[model samples]
Target: MTLPRYAYLGPAGTFTEAALRVMAPEGTAEHLPMVDVPSALGAVRSGEADYAVVAIENSVEGGVTATLDTLAEGEPLVILGEVVLSISFELVARPGTRIEDVARVSAHSHGLNQCRRWIAENLPGALQVPASSNAAAAVALADGSAEFDAALAPPGIGESLGLEVLVSGVSDRASSMTRFVRIGRPGELPEPTGADKTTLVVHLPSDRSGALLQMLEQFSARGVNLSRIESRPRGDRPGEYSFSMDAMGHVAEARVAEALIGLKRTCPVVLFLGSYPAFHGEVTPVEPETTDESFAEATAWVAALRDGRA
Candidate 1:
């Protein structure tokens, strides 16, 4: 009977809030709006919320470094699921203000990047002022605390907050989308959906030339395809780096499990973020040699050979 609590980057009308709505809907869960992504995730880590929804990647900006770095360290949270939302922005300003009157625009860093070309072509003279979030920028404008004249905010935020929409559909790429994940304290993983993704953070055993290749081969040899991969500076040393990757299969699958085992033996640090349902729901095609049956048969064969049964 108690509603689940969800902490997200928000002041109400943010893309993260929208993603949370997609997962929990209005009145279904308690929404706790944090000032930023780290705070949102921190709320979950502190047991202040049941889950946290934050953006991990954007089509235009690629990986969201804040989310990646935060998830890579800390108390260890697992992704429960993901939501990918098509991104679109609205140029909003005070009711009496016009586009030409805007001298400055405020938006989150990623928002600014996605709308960079549009902003350049349309608001050529406007200076970009980065805010913690698009919704925060809108909130600042609405509350008369903003130094910027306009904000690049999610669609509908202008109307909801009593701002004027100077221009709609503001984005360099029409197909731009951001991927958000629902994160929670590590616990029982979701049942393996055929269409799933397993996320991980791996630190190479050494800085040697072949170390990276060896780490990647664990998945490659097991027929586990990687959907996304990025290297982040380990920060402990200048030459060291860690990889954050999304492998295109559930950890429950044989190929994925074997690949993880190989990484455990080779990599110095292998962090299993989680195995969750892919937002797109596209099932990864498994090769015949990598099927669960094949793995079982191979194991049996190895056991038979050990027992001299051939």
Candidate 2:
């Protein structure tokens, strides 16, 4: 049997790698480390890997623009599932280096932002240097190639890489967590678990007033709820924007399907990213009138009326 290949942001020890491990344990699949998120997804698109795992959102940073933009426009891919990991960083430095000796620190942009307050209060004088990833920063520090004296990396990684942990539990928010998705070429979607989420990218028909409301009403009228919705500039036009959303139901559900149909008729571009199992496995509560039975009965009523039997 051939082992599956997974491309993830790496050099090992990144949060994305941890997420991949949650999905596919070590020795079960081949892990390909990419320099960045785009490259990881690209590997999947080019058939270099079976799946790509990348971060989509963080509690403190909100949406990861790179992941959002890359998924919005690309050879179609679908999310297979998601993993949510609590985030905490460790200030790692050369062995015997004290925290006060650190003049510069390196981390990914999101990592820097997440630890901004912590860094301010603790390492007040340290300059922030950006790295491709926190793991990459740790790697640079370990290999003697880093310009920074210390690196903010995932917990346990510093020890694994033979670096000294100067300070642990570094983060502004105690409850910060990152959401990662497993992406693959579109094919059979995961079976509709009652607790599931459907992701999409929608371009509004126009930038006129009430246009945003018009787009949102598709889901509202159908009793579907949105768990997350963020707007990104279309880039083609100044005022134009596209929305990336995670609706709180599976596409296989009647309410979700009808809402999608409504968007298809109104929105100029509606991209269905995928419907996958929600990380927490909490089922979305359906309104009495929006149940599958109700939708089926409504469809039968319409057909009866058309046949002049009602």
Cα lDDT tens digits for candidate 2, 1-310: 8999999999799999999999998789899999999999999999999999999999999999999999988799889999999999999999999999999999999999999999999989889999999999999999999999999999998998899999999999999999999999999999988999999999999879898899999999999999999999987778678999999999999999999999999999999999999999998999999989999999999999999999
User: Model 1, 1-310: lDDT tens per residue?
Assistant: 9999999998888999999999998889999999888999899999999999999999988999999999998899999999999999999998999998989999999999998899899889789999999999998999999999999999999889999999999999889999999999999999998999999999999888899899999999999999999999988779688999999999999999999999999998999999999999988899999999999999999999999999
Backbone clash tally for model 2?
0
Query: 83, model 1: CA deviation in Å?
Result: 1.1
Top lDDT model: 2
Alpha carbon lDDT of each predicted model? 0.94, 0.95
- Residues forming the 10-long window of minimal summed lDDT in candidate 1: 232-241
Q: After aligning candidate 2 to the native by TM-score, how far in Å is the CA of 266 from where it should be?
A: 0.5
For candidate 2, list the clashing residue pairs, or say none. Answer: none
Model 2 ranges off by over 4 Å: none
